[model samples]
Target chain A: MASGNKTTLLFYPSTTNVSAKIHPVVLFNICDSFVRRPDQAERVIGTLLGSVSADGIVEIKNSYAVPHNESADQVALDIDYHHTMYLSHQKVNPKEVIVGWYSTGSGVSGGSQLIHEFYSREVSNPVHLTVDTGFTNGEASLKCYVSFNLSLGDRQLAAQFQEIPLDLRMIEAERVGFDILKTTVVDKLPNDLEGMEATMKRLLALIDDVYNYVDGVVEGRLIPDNNIGRFISNTLSSLPKISPATFDKVFNDRIQDNYALVYLSSLARTQLSIAEKLNTAAQVL
Target chain B: MANTMARSFLQAVATEEVAPPLRVVQMEGLAVLKIIKHCKEFSPALVTGQLLGLDVGSVLEITNCFPFPTREEDDENEADGANYQLEMMRCLREVNVDNNTVGWYQSTLLGSYQTVELIETFMNYQENIRRCVCIIYDPSRSNQGVLALKALKLTESFMDLYRHNSFIGEKLREKKLSWVDIFEEIPIKVSNSALISAFMTELEPDSPVVQCDLDRLKLSTAPFMERNLEFLIECMDDLSSEQNKFQYYYRNLSRQQAQQQTWLQKRRTENIARKAAGEEPLPEEDPSNPIFKPIPEPSRLDSYLITNQVANYCNQINGAAGQSFSKLYLMKALQDN
Candidate 1:
């Protein structure tokens, strides 16, 4: 090993045809009491840059900023202070490795849980987590298998890893996740979403107006007055001239643009039908 | 001495059967002209038909009886020089006065039954009682009609004046009395001779007609006399232009008086209530009270000037006698002739 600002290592696999570039992953580990001592935490984090591999290609990075003063005797207290780091590995051999460590005491006395998640980039499925507990030292090992065949340009693979609406249950699961993705993916997605949102808000306002109008009509708040005539005239004026035709074409052509107008007209038609039926029933009675 | 002789002569004429059919005929003719003239004032259309010898319809017939219709009739007579004297006499006898006198005997009697029917029809159509009677006695009818109309017009004018005078009398009485007390006392002392005499003296200097028994007219007119005078004064006051300062003064005085009365009544009630509650009574300071502020005296000369002007105007419109029948009756009589 050459002691310099950069360091390099060459790995030769037993399989001759499988040649690969292995970029070293840098992990920064802090002591349980380090964050409690601001000076010690700064020293630990400040010294991390010197540990980088010579290739200067950092493939993955993970760090935990935990409150060091957390109590270790109480399980609830220990779990409260526990910092979690999630890493996804698509392929490669899985092995237990001491990624990094910091001293909690003069001797290794405290232990921690390690969790590893693996999944194929092509298919969307439940992530597989391998958790190994019961370490008598303040150290844990994690296995991350980076696939040799994985193309660095495949950002779409990360998108496919997103939770999709498969069956009804997944659809429910995606609601919260998609909401987050929607905000994050704003710059990444198409431009039509903004216009769609605006249109949806307007549609909701119009629907609310229709509901009020219907309620008013039902409650006899809407009476046959000058305003009623004017409203009808104004609404009709907004509509394009329709040729005499069946009710469907008339409704579709003239009223489809204004939901409130369409709803009112439909209500009016329904009332007219009811009135006609009543009249016929009355005559029979 | 002249009044006594005139009275004795009238008495003799009433008692004695002196055959003065010719004088009666003359009077009858005059009465017809008077009636015709009065009726013509109401509707010139009647005069037009009489003058032009045009056939009359039920509309004209009714219009001929009304002093004023809801609206003026069309086809009013313009020809005042036509010879309608005989025809007018006949019409008067036919419709208004007696037909048996010399001046009216040869005149075509529309017949008593037919005349009554025509009058009934006229009344039905005209509907207004005052106007209908006025037109019925149009001088264009005959001399008898003219005389009757003249008497009627005089009576109406007198009644109007008497009404104004009585109103002033009542208001004067109300000066010292409460409205409730006035109303209560009015019926009791209404026929009191002293009040009537005072009212008459205050209104007119020529108090009684001893020669003629006009007691019925006096008694019947007494209550209304002061009222009629007050009405006349008001009419005169109103007829004066707004520029007349006297009118303004009088109106302001009336208003102030009304306000003072209202204030006094209110204070009286408040005092009675306070006394009942054992509260101190308010001091009675008359002139200090805002409502009792004295009104400026009106210029009597200016008022007289305005009143004279209005009276002149009324006289001009009403004609020389200031009788309602004079203008209308004379116009109709001349037109028919």
Candidate 2:
């Protein structure tokens, strides 16, 4: 809460602390940068471009890789390149300022403080995102941290990277593409007609899941959760009430319209081809 | 790793004189996300970017991309935009990413991207890059639970005719090209690294599906259909106007033809009279006569684009209607039970 880190939590109250919400793009960007890193480099760091909301949530939306040379004893980042790239990104997206910095590796390293110290001057309480690109534990562990200054007497000696809560959020459009990518790894993507079947199948599966849970609770086989019951009922009540005849008519109308549209489009294409042919034929005179 | 493979492919292909015919546009998952983020962030306002990838054998792989600076309407800003792109690519090259300019991408609204300006942009790119694709992303259409991203390229035959500034019907017939031949859409394949795929698997909850999948089953598709209809009607009007231009051209052409016939008839009679009188006869065809001048036929490029737009809208409406029908029936069955 802001009681102790009041200067850091400018947008938060004393109770709920700051949390980091990352968009899928940022994670993809960090992974890309790590994949394209210099052959000898251990980690790749980048500037996180996003904005902080009034509720103390840092939403990272974009990022660009910053070339850095790090060793066991020293670390050097191309400060000029970072500033120039940030300015270039700013020209297009003025709203997304420097929210934090992201690095790829297992965990925070000793030189992270130096880099964090540099970023602190650029932004206050900047977030340090560590993506385990190494896949250390059979998976990449996404960890976001904030540093706290450790002072001995009056001199600040070091900054500690304290872990914070991180959540992954994606927009509807991104979800569509991500779904395709995820599915492509296992099988070929579905076309238009197949897409409809896929959607219906998923919906039916979800309904079955909810029905089973509710059925178990009703039979006293499983303990019922009030939140689950309310949510299920809410969705149930949202369905429309109509006579079966009216529903059949509406369904028929939809199918007919869809067929008509497809027919019209194909007809238009055929006409276009014919028109082109005739126009060219007439030009011969 | 895809990184080393992409680089080796680039080296192998860059040395070739003529690249093989592109069979697919394989895009890295990272590139797709970057495009989605850039486009969704600035919806309604048009945005474009550069795609950096390798043109491997029979497959144009898009490994990375960066957005261009949103420019002002001036020549100075135009130059600045170019410099910014170069600088950004330079910075990316320092980090060892794909820096080759394979093509560019732009966001559209409701699939209104089939335009002359788009063709002009392609022509501009053709000067430097031999093979490039223009990725079109429609943020508005993506609301319908479909990934509205496409890679388009000018058909080689169309580009050849376009370069000569000739959309003449005679040339089109000779080339056997049609309106639909103006652009070729290459199929897109999404590819990702094994590490990224594993990471994504970790991100999922105990459930196999995402929470957002519920939105796909919503029965309210009225807005999407309405917008498609609006665009379709506008395109129809544009197509008619294009047709009107041709009508006007043919009318004037007939008038000119009639005037030439009259002048020729009079000249023949005059020549006969002059011969009887032993004087030199006047030439039947006069180079200085205004009636002999040729009228340039209007180009059919605009109408071709309009037709393409109308077809795209119709296809979209059909897809959305089909999806909505399925959702509606599922709801109906649920209600009955």
Candidate 3:
């Protein structure tokens, strides 16, 4: 799978960074190349490049599929080519380094060890990322494996592939975009009446939770915390002082305006269709 | 030179149509992750789901899918189940996603996916939707560091054989079919939008320290190799038994042929003798006999599937062995250094 080279990762300024955060762009690239290959082969190999935050959090930014090569010599050449390309990419954005490599499909295969060995030569502690790009229901499963070299008798070997937890972290903007993409899949438009209704429903549910908490405190079933009380008072004070009658009138007017807009749009559509019909009839005559 | 190669690769990608002549199955990354989650949730039990996506001629874009609910069996309840599924699809339609059942997905254990139920299900779907595919999710293999997500479709020959319920040697030979060709694996692509790419790019920042962790090189292929061996052994046993059964049939057929020839020759001589005596030749030698009844040949599809399964297991084992050998080789070389 070709991990999209275009999508870059923006590192968030976090005080504590322990885990690797994968940018969605790398995923896009993997998916793109995976499906677009001339022959629909399951095995796709690519290199993972990203910058690690000061706190050991790896932020995967870019990836490119290593073109399929059958010969051992060709594979080595391809690896070199990938390294040069990565260096060129680093020139433009010097933050990223060769973090690891990725392959489309799940589970490390027989060839995976060989591929992993090649990547190991390029980077120390190369993370072998397996993106399960095969669709069953929803979402491509991503797995990060860190190899551990072990000693068996007198010979030392990489004895284990330990899976590391992958955090698919997105910035605030990305999160919003992700949510919008999710909604679009279901044909739910953001900022529409249905969206607003769903938001209101969630808001009401939160209010119910808050009301229950207050009731519990009032009835002595629970104790209220000073911080929570302070927060509630602060929130209440921040509320705009609007009369109930005016609030109702404003809400009604907004709803009416929305209905009128819908009606006007429908009328315009009908008029356009009628005009087109008349023009066609006149032409025929 | 690399730049030219990269450019050519890009050109290839740009010129490539989203859809090819044969239907291409593409899935969003999130959809695959969801299936893995579903499989994990229902571990030790067979889980199945309906694939919902748009089928644009050559590209089957699987946008979403939902797990099918287990239903209680009753003669009348079957209708209710169908209606309930329809209602669910209708709800999906309201959401503007492809609600059509393009195919279905099932979680398999140890790649033991070929089964009567799976074939029957594929046929049922094929009867309605021509481009339907079955996506198999293997969680155990995934846990061992490879995500086993595969898109499978019944080959036309296999489907035809299935429709006719004929997997006999003659039919198989006539169709030129084999187990490997039974399930045509459509390459899967996980797709994302430009917006996602842009967002990912925004998340990058420069860091001074490059992590070179030694722990990442460790690997353990023993357990996986063992499992593969076990499965391979089972497959071998199944294959051998199938071969033995076919051998038995061959033996029986040959024995019957010999007996029939002897009986026919005796009848011919008797008829000749009767003609020489000027008698009406004993009602033209009827070859019909209880001993000549044909022995039914068992379908070779199962054996073929087992053979393929065995090959798959062998490939996996070989990979594990090769990886282990390399690891050892690296360690030994380092020791010498």
DockQ of 1: 0.00
Which candidate ranks first by lDDT, i.e. highest?
2
Question: Per-residue CA lDDT of candidate 3, range B153-252, in tens?
Answer: 8887788888888987667666766556788887776654553334334333232111111111234555665676677668768877877887788788
Q: Indicate which candidate wins on TM-score.
A: 2
lDDT of 2 by residue, B243-275 (tens): 889889989999999999999999999999999
Model 1, B1-337: lDDT tens per residue? 9999999999997765543211000111112222332233333333212111111221111111101111233344213212223333343332222222111111111101112233233334234322222212222222111111211011222233323443232232333221111111000000112221222222221322211111111112222223333443454555344235644766787888788778888888999999999999875557777767776543222222233333322322222112222223332332333
Summarize candidate 1's per-residue lDDT along A204-239 as a digit string, tens digits.
565467568767877999864567557756864774
Worst 10 residues of 2 chain B by lDDT: B205-214
**Over all chains combined, what TM-score does candidate 3 have?**
0.50
- The lDDT of each candidate is 0.28, 0.80, 0.62
Q: Would you list the rank order by TM-score, best first?
A: 2, 3, 1
Clashing pairs in 2: none
TM-scores for all candidates: the values are: 0.14, 0.89, 0.50
Task: Indicate the TM-score of model 2.
Answer: 0.89
lDDT of 2 at A84: 95
Count of residue pairs whose backbone atoms collide, per candidate = 62, 0, 45
